[model samples]
Target: MSCRTVASFISLFLATTAAVQAQTELGNFSNVARGGVATTFVTDFQAIGINPANLGRNDNARVAFTIGEVGVGVGSQALTRTQLRKFIEDSGEELNMAQKQEMARTFTSDNVLNLNVDATPVAFSVVLPMVGSFAFSSRQRVTTHLGLNKNTAELLWLGKDAPIYPANFNPATAPLVSEVLEGTSIQMAAYNEYNLAYGRQVLSLPAFVLSVGAGYRYIQGVGVVDVRSKDGQLEAYSALSPQFNVDYGSVVNNPSFNLQKDTDKLLQPVGRGHGYDVGIAAEVGKKLRLGASVTDIGQMTWEGNLLTANDQKLKRLRSNGADSYEFFSELADIFASGTDSLFQYKPAQERKASLPTKFRAGAGIRVGSRLEVGADVTMPLNDVAGNIPAAFYGVALDVKPLSWIRLSTGVTSGAGYGMGIPVGFAIATKVYELGFGTRDLRGLLSDERPYASVAMGTLRFKIGTVK
Candidate 1:
């Protein structure tokens, strides 16, 4: 089949199986904090990803790995006593007990459904610094999403038996059914980033030391649907049909086609992209440091085909039979047959894969031989449509009470007045060093305190010391 034809089939499948695929969240900034303040020690790995100039600052060779988890929840509530009274007045009869029960369940569930997400980031990096302040490093990062459960599922399943159309069969009812069925989808996505970079000091003038560096990056993302159901038995109908169930989800046993086949086709050809990073860092005074970098100035393209299945048996059956007899057929034929094929593709539109670009600047000041304070500001340079701009500001204090002990603390602020505090400690001997830290302690406080709740912990050990 032609590419256009395949794309049309995919689009139709997505629409039909709308309830089976859930919305996915991408390009979150929270992962940035994993590098922390001590990033300067073996910081070359994170520097390539955060700020390229960072590679010039390290005097030692080291390796480090960090793992972190982030969880976010958002909800809203309103007092609608007046609106409820008006609603009752408009109804001729008082709401029965069953109606009241449903109202209570819906209100409670809606409030809980808003936005709740949990993600884990695993990262590792190795850095080697050579004579005359030159360094090379490699870093790898992966983000794993657990799952998303919007409360709408309960609401849709509860109302499934309700008449989709009253005696009038108005066109408005069709949209209402579509909206209701959209709630029953399952979505999951995973992202991986790999970077390799090299850095060297270019100038060591009397007033300052200036360094520059660059690197390449490779990124990949995949999204999958594990379960999907829409408008009661619609999915089951598609699954049992000879055309749809065999063509898609064939790897799984006893698949239920709750949505149109075109829905699955729309999500084909998972997103992939690559980009580059550049950085510069300068030491202004004996004890002062400043740096900046930009990353991910690249675009990705999505490619896939679309297929629609029409169960002719469904048109002649009722209830369960409608789901069991559905079949995969051409979109043109379905349109001609006069049965709504939510699985038809729109040939004119293309889904572009756009990644966010980021810019960051930071400064650090050393106090005597034992203490240092630093701050950084980061913002999105460019973002895709409908993507939110993320701005991050952080300040940290590092203390060396003895050659063997290092302590640090910092606060970070971001969009939406969100803020967090991180505390860390590291112990070092001649041959080995260990570190631990807690980020986003604001979680210990309430929302009224001017920040979102967040928490993170990390550990790093030195494998070998540089000469």
Candidate 2:
């Protein structure tokens, strides 16, 4: 692929992938403070994906709604904060031999890039005297992860100019592409989710109130891509929307190329599926709360514009080399080398993959009406593309010094990316709410690799005081 084509594809990938995180609940930035301890604290429509049981608890308002709540996060440990900034600024300076060697070494390690986004356009919920609570929500989630192994990293960083490619390289005697580039991968998915849920009080005893709830989700996928190489074997799959306008070139003549002419200007759905969420929550004397839930019990079958990669041996390095600062374009050059390249595409009919299903449970205690503390644990039920790499544990605190001002902070560990400290601020009232928060406050201050995150909302309101 030409550098221009690669650049275009990268831009589209980044723009459309503005969906959300691997943790479904984390997408609801409105409750970002309780993201680490959501089981019991999340309520109203906010609890739709986390723990529906919370909906059973009586809300202060008979009706509640929210719009324009968004969360976004992106980070990488591959390059330090300063180094990344310099690269992006692109001074147009040539790298010295020593600097190039250092970079080549730095890129050889297992480098990872994570991009996540979640936006809730609207959500509504209402409580009925004897009918319990009912809620509906529309959410968009997109997540992407890119990991580069040693060989893949070197090729992108040093290009064909790397020492490994011998002074005089020959395509006929060159090593197999699989043997050269092992342990690299890219996974991305974008989709829309609509949820309908119900929760009701099941038991009420003076000091104890127990509630059970269930939620149903309808999902429509927009695009998906999965590529990996391991043990001298490579596999790739993609089902993208026609809006991307990807050029398959002469490969269209290949029998594996299944072309469906879709002339839609709007982002069309490429796949669809459904899932269910169930939970139970209990309150003890209005001070202590406990809850547990399971979510995303389903799978997506991608068929729209499906394309799979055929394992091919490396033939030749066409381009002279990519500019050092043009990292993504270089990646495009590597992956989109047309036929006889490492990734040769053929048309596919369908591919099925599971959602990032997870189990979540937590406990919280309220100290009077101003101080609250909580702890939570989450584990993945399936090893899907969006699932956390490991179990997660967190402890958090919320302090309300004024009737309208609230502050939250927490310490978290696990979930693949080491430790983090989360913080948030909010102006909350019985009639409405507004807030902003981040999953990790330390990331913003880090000099080395830093992970940046932010979640905020301005349009949230409550109506009709519950009687």
For model 2, which pairs clash?
19-117, 19-142, 20-117, 20-142, 256-347, 257-347
- Off-target runs (Cα >4 Å) in candidate 1 are 1-42, 62-189, 224-269, 304-351, 384-389, 415-417, 445-467
lDDT of 1 by residue, 326-436 (tens): 111221122211223323222112234455577777888878878878887777775332122356677877778997887767786652234667555666554444554
- What's each prediction's clash count? 28, 6
Q: Which stretches of candidate 2 lie over 4 Å from their true place?
A: 1-10, 13-25, 86-97, 109-111, 161-182, 230-234, 253-265, 310-322, 337-340, 465-467
Error of 1 at 389 (Å): 4.1
Question: How many pairs of residues in model 1 come into backbone collision?
Answer: 28
What shift in Å separates residue 331 of candidate 2 from its native position after superposition? 1.4
Model 2 lDDT per residue over 1-467, tens place: 22233345445545433443212237655355544667767878888888999889865368999997877766566777666555545556666556766766666644466667678899999999988999999988877667777767767666666655776777678787667778776666778899999999999899998999999999998777676677988767777666666676665666655564567546578788898999999999979999999988889988876776676666555543445655666666677544323565667777888988999999999898888888999998975556665688888888999978889888877665446778888888887888888777776678666666778888889887655
- Candidate 2 — worst ten consecutive residues by lDDT sum? 16-25
Q: 19 in model 1: Cα distance from truth in Å?
A: 28
Best by lDDT: 2
